[model samples]
Target: MANKKSTKTPAKAKKSDKKPGLIARGKAYMASVRSEMKRVVWPTKNELVNYTVAVCASLIVVGVSIAVLDLVISEGLVLFASLRG
Candidate 1:
């Protein structure tokens, strides 16, 4: 008697190749964000205030310098144009 191979069909296995839907992706992204946030070492109150003041002072200095340069250049241009005319 010859041994024969079984011809029965195998059961279908579930496939996980599909991409996650929008809500699932959003939840995963938020979870990752929250996890990263937990690892942050935030600045203290004094450090925050010092940084704020430094930024404001730098801005004021830059603004004043730009304004003075603009005024000087404009006046010089007016004088040169008037002398030429």
Candidate 2:
């Protein structure tokens, strides 16, 4: 069998072989992305509302917990600093 001669150089061969024009490929990619996005299972209005309220309540609880911890730590640091002075 005869050996096949490569027409492409090493650098050019390393790049993508299936390179299409930018605009055409971008439009095709966007069309595929839109179709895939349509397949997503979005939450209903009631479920969305419930999730929003749950997140807000958790945020408030965490905020208060952090504030209380900050106050306790600040007081302890101040007391220790005063004793050292």
Candidate 3:
């Protein structure tokens, strides 16, 4: 007896072949976002303020570090060029 292969495609494969329309896809994406947002744990007002302050402090520190590094490298390059001439 010979084994025969099944000819039927999966239900999912047939549906997957045809994509949802742009408006339908957008609506579905927005619905999923709303569902996820509903499950989110929101920070309290104090927590939000603390987070903002932490972020601003971090930005200031990073900016100052980059500026210092730039100044040091530029001055070193100028000193090296002067020594060569």
Judged by TM-score relative to the true structure, which candidate is superior, 1 or 3?
Answer: 1
Residue-wise lDDT of candidate 1 within 1-85, one digit each (tens)?
7999889989877787789999999999999999999999999999999999999999999999999999999989999889645
Cα lDDT tens digits, model 2, 25-61, are: 9999999999999999999999999999999999999
Task: Give the Cα-based TM-score of candidate 1 against the true structure.
Answer: 0.77
Q: What are the runs in model 2 whose C-alpha is more than 4 Å off?
A: 1-18, 83-85
Each candidate structure's TM-score, on Cα atoms with residue i matched to residue i, is 0.77, 0.73, 0.67
Clashing pairs in 2: none
lDDT of each: 0.95, 0.93, 0.93
Task: Quote the lDDT for 45 in model 1.
Answer: 100
Q: What clash count goes with each model?
A: 0, 0, 0
In the order shown, the candidates' Cα RMSDs to the true structure are: 7.0, 5.6, 4.7
Q: How does candidate 3 score on lDDT?
A: 0.93
Decide which is better by lDDT, 2 or 3. Answer: 3
Count: clashes, candidate 3:
0
Tell me which of candidates 1 and 2 scores higher on TM-score. Answer: 1
